[model samples]
Target: MLWLDVTHRPGQAPWVRLMGRYLLPPCKQRWHTCAAFLPQGGLLVCGDRRGSLLLFPCSSSPGWAVESAGIADGGTSPVSEDTGSGSEPSCLSHKGALPLEAPLSVLFGLHGKMGVTSVTCHEGYIYSTGRDGSFHQLRLQGQQLEVLRKHRPCKGLQWIEELRFTPDGDLLVLGFHADNFVVWSSRTGENLHCIPCGGGHRSWSYCSNASAEAFAFVKCGDVMLYHREAEPCEQRVLLESLHGREIACVRRLGAVEVPGHTTLNIFVTGSEDTTACVLALSERSRAAMPLTRLSDHISSVRALALASPVGVFGLLEAARKLVLVAESFHHQRCVLKVEAFLHTWAGGERHLLCSAATDGSIAFWDITSPITDATDALHRAEGEIQPLGGCSCQRLCSASRGRPRWWLLCSLPPSTTFFHVPDLAELDCWEVAEAGGELRYYCVLCGRGLEMLHGIAPPESPLLGAPQ
Candidate 1:
């Protein structure tokens, strides 16, 4: 095994240094497959093809790292070149690296001939599993590894692949049997659940929170989610066919508060299938149920923008169609009823609204003023700003600095531009105070993963600000 030292600088990329190398025990059938580092530092546990767990002491006192630099050409060096240059190699080793350090202990035949597949250390005990359909626990005693317990295969679980423990300390074993993925619990030594997923070769994940446990796996080309609540409940597929095609964007609309019921959040999703879907997410059930699906777009629905207070939303399509939707919360039905909408921006004034149309025109309106019908409101774009180079604005956000400023996202060329609207009628504080307070940091979602940006406050920012 090769040991490496990695170092990172303040503003530059990290660099690695070669530390030391050690040789593993020789095996005829198979070699090391999985490994785990013990909770206590300087000790590594490796599982090999012969169903044995080997412990290697990587501490500095072992002389592997301490004397690695002074290891001369031949002074008790772990590596030795073969005098018979034509002889076949027995074990792999570094030519000029430090001599091999024998393992502190090796526990053999723990998983029989199936070979160890995974090794993990929890608390202070070592746990290993193999295709032999069982997992064994071992403890380090002096220089030897003693087998403490063996958990045999649960019914229907024939070949074990891996195991993990829940936050509550219940052991969860994952494996396959009869072409189905099975989860077995060590607390009861029984099958917790089974999902027919063809075989164990596919990708899968299992997670548990205080109230529920979730398992997701890929079957064929579709993803399946399974949920189990801490309290006994019937299982069901909460969402069916969320979209006709791949989803492109998702945005939270708002939250609904109802007495004695789960707090539900409203979310809107745009899809490549030329549709937008409204969903109600229930925290208690851990399910997202579709409330409505808007299928009026001619092309793919690529982006969505929402103005929650007035229930106005905008859906941007691949084609030049910007559809406006207005929805109202129906408490009795626990649903939102759509009225009419496009891309809406409520400025510093709540009554005065602005929207960007597909034809690249900006329209302003006094929503609180009298309107005979929806048709009147749609046609009455009181003060229309001329089209800007035929580029439709897909999104709009209003910011305030004594007067209202609008941020617009343009389509076709896909650019962001801000406008200082000084003459727009009646400004009500469209910009709401920050809900909790000024943010200390913010997160940006990127292709790789979420990135956190810290130091949100400027060097001269105040320690306290106006409360929400």
Candidate 2:
């Protein structure tokens, strides 16, 4: 197994070092659903198989604190018996003596709830759906969790998969079973429209905003674009038989300009079939056509994100490039994960392609140089693969920075690991002891490292070498 340090300063070659390994404490209950990052940062919201929600904060202080919103008898623990008098705990004080400010707000699901598969945030509002035939709207106002609105018996929307907000802040929900995709008003929770997506054994489906009136969702080898025209929504199947596999993630690359022609919108999709495809959407047709293919991974591609510049530039120049990170697993174990930085150049040509594989190995390729034929376009050359230390990463997200600064969340059972990219190096690790009760999720609000209370380390802090 190769380990890559997630952090390295710009312009300097990353150094290889093996840090101590840690494990995440086993939760009282197993978590089988997905986790999402908050809009501002420092907070991660996750839902469990049992329809329970947990918030985890990234902190540098002592003692980890988790708040359960809906689990029965499972909310924030009391600060101290004599601590403060209120419906909520004055503070969350752990055995490590770490103190957490009273939760700003907390939302609990209906009792004994199940099938809350995904959660997403936009413009300070949290939207969620579940198997219970419910759609929920929550707002975090100060330290209070208030339900803005709730719609039940959403009719055809059951087993919701993911929730997303369009660039215009309209709510979009992807569900499982019948008429799986629906769009709603963020403020009023009104169902704008619903579309029937196929059911059974699906991977992650991603939705990205195309225009104020249009958005796209990619899944199961197809990309569907929807536009709000009159009263109801209009739908178009932009691309089908894409990569011949289930789409894992999709991101709008921005736009590209063609001299003497209308601009084009580009979108990228990663799939389980080990391929990433970029599609160009024409303004006139509002239809996406295949642009490029990134065949760098040997296994299923788990996640994909375009560089901020590529995404912004796509929106600007109407030309967008993408950086795709993929994880390959065999027999349920991660074999190798690779990251690639690729761009589409002028005249819709595929240009630069840079990749880093799991063995702390990196490769850079220039796809501009023409070969004997257009069919043989890419030129492969090896760069440097510096080994950091870690087995594999569970989640990865890019920073809001202009350049590529990726945050990778690596799970090493019983320990929560954090890594940054450019040169994949470990930035911080928290050793979580196995405890019996269910562990909830939390996120830090401030990004300037974790804050310690009374000299006690915060459990969520990624800073290493602090007091345990």
Candidate 3:
């Protein structure tokens, strides 16, 4: 394990520097499963796949002396690094020196053959769960751990994987028995609910209050939600697992009329499972049917762009890298240092693109010409606008006025900015029609939600100052 020092300066991002690292013993198979830090003592408790708990004292900061250290129980010694001369035992190593230390204590075979899945601390005691269908409450004594109590297997739970406490001070045990996922309450020592989720190898979450409880899990690649309250319990399928996991992004591509059927809205969705799909939505029944899936990407698809007649652009997530693909012309171009692609629109006779960067700057680009085999169609942007650090550009929409005006949503302060399109002159007031064709002047901003007020007039003075 490694530790680092974090430094944060005013008006600057935080910086993390490496402090020190601990070295594990050689010739030992230590497949760690869970770990937690002690609240009172400067110690770290770790559990391994071998059902063993190891405790290491982190009392000393960096720059400690180096020496050969053996396990307190005389079982194994800390691993030794091979210097030019010979091998020497080392427990912890500083940034500039080779200082090593061994674990303070090691308790072997606490859970028999099954591995420890989780370890957590509450109050002054530590609780651990194992795949052996049981959990144990432990306390620290000097450098060793003493078992305070052992809990029996929850009802209908044969293989315990996790243990959590509810807000109402009840212990919650989650595991799998037979072919179902089970949740048991320690306060009543009874099974709270059982869901036929195939097994416990998938992702799951549970939350409960005094009045209601909700459990969500994945089965057969589909997300399922189970809510239990005073009334009859409800269970429903949230999203199908066709993409295998949660979808990342979705955009409406407009509507199409099916033969003999109602009109359907066409949408493109990108998923974390590394695929993009085209789906048809029936507004009448509120159902989405997948039409086709694109499996060309090997990474999670985070963003998508559609250029009709040209092609679809699927963005595979990567740090600070942007690539635009024009499928119809079979051309791929790299955009240097562009952070996020916000919105794209057609302006008179030119195609325009807006993008924001991590450094709080926005840019407008023109890509009107068609892509060719020899050159990319991207042209120099009209200008760049550098804003305050906390400014987050949400959505941009054009006004229907004769003189082009644009509305920009700055979500940080929950306000709107209006300006002329090309020249970007700050405007005091402007009118824009919503998607449903209602004219609205000012946007009533709530926390993460927007309500367009039609009769409300814009402020007499500009909402934002001129960009410098």
What TM-score would you give candidate 3 relative to the actual structure?
Answer: 0.39
Taken over the whole model, the C-alpha lDDT of each candidate is 0.56, 0.43, 0.56
lDDT (tens digit, per residue) of candidate 2 on 1-468 = 111122334443222232211222234544436555577665555555566554555343323323222222433343333534444331122222432322233344431357466677766887666666565667665534456755542334456656665566455555554634555543333465556555534443444434335545566787766555444347654535555545655555566879988866566666665666677756476455776566436566657543321111111111121222221221222223323354655656555544444334444555444212222221221222111211222223333321223233422123232422232211211222225543322221112212111111124435422211
Per-residue C-alpha lDDT of model 1 across residues 327-433, encoded as one tens digit per residue: 33222222222233234456432344554433344445554423233335445434331121122333333333322233323321222223333222222111212
Off by over 4 Å in 2: 1-29, 37-42, 60-112, 141-144, 179-197, 204-468
Deviation of model 1 at 304, angstroms:
70
Q: Please estimate how well model 1 matches the true structure, expressed as its whole-model Cα lDDT.
A: 0.56
Stretches of candidate 3 off by over 4 Å are: 3-14, 23-29, 59-98, 167-169, 230-468
Better of 2 and 3 by TM-score: 3
Candidate 3 local accuracy as lDDT? 0.56
Model 2 whole-model lDDT (C-alpha atoms):
0.43
RMSD to the hidden true structure, all candidates: 26.1, 30.7, 24.0
